[model samples]
Target: MMRKTLTSVWPLFFGLGIIGVCIGAQGSLLGIRAELEGFDIRVTGLLMSAYYVGFLLGSLRAPKILQRVGHIRAFAALTALASITILVHSLIIDPWTWGLMRLLTGFAVSAIYVVAESWLNQAANNRSRGQLLSIYMVTMLAGLSSGQFLLKLADPASFELFTLISVLISLAAIPILITATPMPSFEAARPVSIKALYHLAPTGLIGSFLINTCYAMVLGMGAVYASKLGMQVDEISLFMAVLVVGGMLLQWPLGKLSDRMDRRSVICAAAFAALLFALVSGQTGFAADNRHLLLALLFGGCCFPLLALYLALTNDELTSDQAVGASSTLLLVGGIGATLGPFMISLTMERWGAPGFFWCLAAMSALMAGHAFYRRLIDPLPAAGEPSSFQMQAPSPVGSGLMKSPPSEN
Candidate 1:
């Protein structure tokens, strides 16, 4: 059964993996290039933030586009747009122009995820869904990690890297466009009220918001921090790669552990551990050597799977019908957090220097830890059997499968 399911979805997995490579490399490449170009931290932060702005808008609008065009056509159109946008970055050097490209890139990427994930979900059944989701997550992480090492391929200061990114984005479209597989039907999810979502799962809602805020801080600013520390591009690549590797290696073990105990406890433990790692990486003078790399590994291990826990907790409180709405609401909150994270963290970095990046991360992780424990005290866990079965969640807000509404009953 597993083999058969895998066989069926191989194309989707392959396409998504390629997309991950493009995304991972493009982010680091742009950050490094922006620094080399002498763009200010504020402009860099805004450049990063613009992507999330476009992403949030794309998530809201992509479903309508999908409904009109169908998955394959939508995927092709978005991929082509993304490819063109990456090349545009190479032709232009201004922060404003790069920011505009990032915005379009984010929109295209978000819609691509919508097409990919919704197709995967349609291909899955109850028994195989969990396994497929795990495979999808691993594939994404592996692709992201591998892409980081591609930084060694060309200098960020040159146009070659941007061209490579465009090539990858273009390649991602080929598998889906050529596949004989039928397109999955997409139903647009109605927006849920934030007030109702808060009432349903306050802990999950707040944690999702704060966690993504931290994520955006790290992903958007980490490259800039490394560059400022005088690390070469290759070292920066390894740093980013190790962070993703840590997340990939640890997700399953941590996920399984959460299933056996109170998930909130696991969340608190992960948050606290992440906070400690961030502090060590940021504050200790000795950490400037290889010690910081190890710390980054530990940090990613603890930090990456947080959204899964948040989604699991949220799902536990929601009916299937409400699941779609709740996921959309939670993603919106997360998007808002991501949109603001880089700008706020950039201000800190400006005042406090590179260490400010990790300080900001530590502070956010501490907030998440503290809130998780407080919620545990006030709201008890559901009975062991009562919680929804755990499933691996994609890292991005846009790809949560619950974004698709269920078919209507006659």
Candidate 2:
């Protein structure tokens, strides 16, 4: 019975894993490729941010496109488009050109997530929703981690690696395309009003943005930061891997703790921890001969979870439907922050040196933590038994303009 059950869900798990690999490769490869091609760090940051701009724009429009195209068609079309976009990177050298390609890739990939996640949600039964979601999460994490290691096998300086990733992305379509089982139809996108959500829960929304800003900055430039600090390409991969790995290790405990206590408190604590780590690690920079590996690990472990925790905490204040829409909106906001994070940090790094990148992150983290603390005093907490993790969070009136209707149920 157990074996049959496991086998039955293999396709969905595999599909989600592919999604993870696609994104992980995009994030890691873009950073490395930008540097090897001799683009300035700011350009690299701008290129990465271009993707987020695409993401934000896509999130708004993708639902309409998906509705007309249908799920499988939309997924296939976007995946193929993304593959082509990535492949173009191999042929092009100009920063603006690459940035445009990155934008298209981002828009397409964000739609892919909407389609894929909706499929996963549809396939799951009430009894198995949690299990399936957990499986999906793990697949995503592993696929992303695997993408990093793929860096080791390919030569980063050559176009072969980017082409190889494009191939992998193109191949990812096979399992979904060939599977005998039919996936779910896309949910019709809905309008998620920023004002309404703000009146509902403020802390989560703001925290969501802050956490996303941190994450976007890190993913966009952590490797570049490593390389500038004198680590080799392989070490850069390992550095990114360790940061993600630390987040993986802490996600469960931090989530559980948030469930039990004041989520605001949890977020504040996590941010403070991130601030401390970033201060130490960012200030010291990586030294000769991998002297700072431990600092990096500790820094990653401590700071990465702050995003997840803040997210989880934010969700704790939302309704189920609200949670879904709110999460997507928050994701869009985070994408914005992520897009800008690399560019801002890169400029700082160029002006003041490598440590400047981390100094920015530390300052951002501290500001967010302080904001959460202030909200705790000014706002009323959610009632007990609210679905914290899956509900859509509304920010206060002051920040209410950021909310939007849920993405259309295509």
Candidate 3:
């Protein structure tokens, strides 16, 4: 059964892997490049935040696009736009132009995730759903993590890295565009309002926003922070790769543990873990000691899965009918947080220097852990039925298979 599932989805997965590679490389590439160009830290923050702003916009608009053009055409168009935009970053050196392109890239990438996840969800049966989603997460992590190594392939100052990213994005289209599989049908669900979502699952809603804020800080500014600490490109790539792998390693175990007990407990533990790591990182001077790899792993493991945990926490309180719509709400909330995190962190960094990065992380972690414990005390209600099962998340509205799985014919 697993073999047959792989056969059916190989083309899609292969293409998605390429997309993962592009995404992983592009953010760090731009951040490193910005540092090399001597762009102001706050300006770089604005540039990075623009992507999340565009992402929020695209996530809202993408369902309509997928509905109109269908998946194949929508995917093709978005990838082509993203491909062109990434290469343009190399041609133009201005922060404003890069900001524009970064926004476009975010817009295109978010929609592409909608396409990829929506298509995968439609392809699964009950038995295959878990297997497929598991494979999907692994493929994404492996691809994205491996792509970090591509940093070692060329100088950050040269156009070569950007070109490599462009080439990967372009090649991703080939497998997807050529697939003979039937296109998935799509319908945009009416999203629950933030007020409604908060009322329903305060912990989940607030957690999503807070955790993603920290996440975006790291994603947008991590390379920049590392560069500021005087690390070389090769060391930066390895450190970055360690962060990705750390998240992958912990997501499943924590998810399984969440399914068995109060997820908020796991959520609290994870958040506290982050706080501890952040404290340690800050004290250690944010890579002052030689344990750059260890600090990166501990940091990634503690922080990366919080959004997914919050997604499940929200959905645990939702009826199946509402789960689909809430996916958009949670993603939008996270995106908004992501949009603001970098600029805020950049200000902190400017004020305190490199250690400011970990300080911001520690504060966010404290808030998340404190809130989760507080909410659990105030509202202890569980889902009316079994809680929604946790999955390793992909940060897309649909593709992460966060919605209750479609009823199985089998």
Instruction: Report lDDT (CA) for all predictions.
Output: 0.83, 0.68, 0.83
Task: Write one digit per residue (lDDT tens) for candidate 3, span 360-403.
Answer: 99999999999988877876765556777777875333334233
Tens digit per residue, CA lDDT, model 2, 301-345: 666666656666656666666666665666655666666776878
Please give the distance, in angstroms, between residue 215's alpha carbon in candidate 1 and its true position after superposition: 1.5
TM-score pick, better of 2 and 3: 3
Native-to-model Cα distance after best TM-score fit, residue 313 in candidate 1, in Å:
1.0
Q: Give the residue spans of candidate 3 off by over 4 A.
A: 286-289, 380-384, 395-410
CA RMSD, predictions in order: 2.3, 4.6, 2.6
Candidate 1 lDDT by residue in tens digits, 170-259: 887787788776667778777679999898888889998998887777778778888988889999998888887887778778777877
Model 2, position 152: C-alpha lDDT score: 79
- lDDT: worst 10-residue window of model 3: 401-410
> How close is every model to the real structure, measured as TM-score?
0.96, 0.88, 0.95
Give the lowest summed-lDDT range of ten residues in model 2: 391-400
Evaluated against the true structure, the overall lDDT of model 2 is 0.68
Each model's total of backbone clashes: 0, 31, 1
Clashing pairs in 1: none
> Any runs in candidate 1 off by more than 4 Å, and if so which?
285-289, 381-385, 402-410
Q: Score candidate 2 by TM-score against the native.
A: 0.88
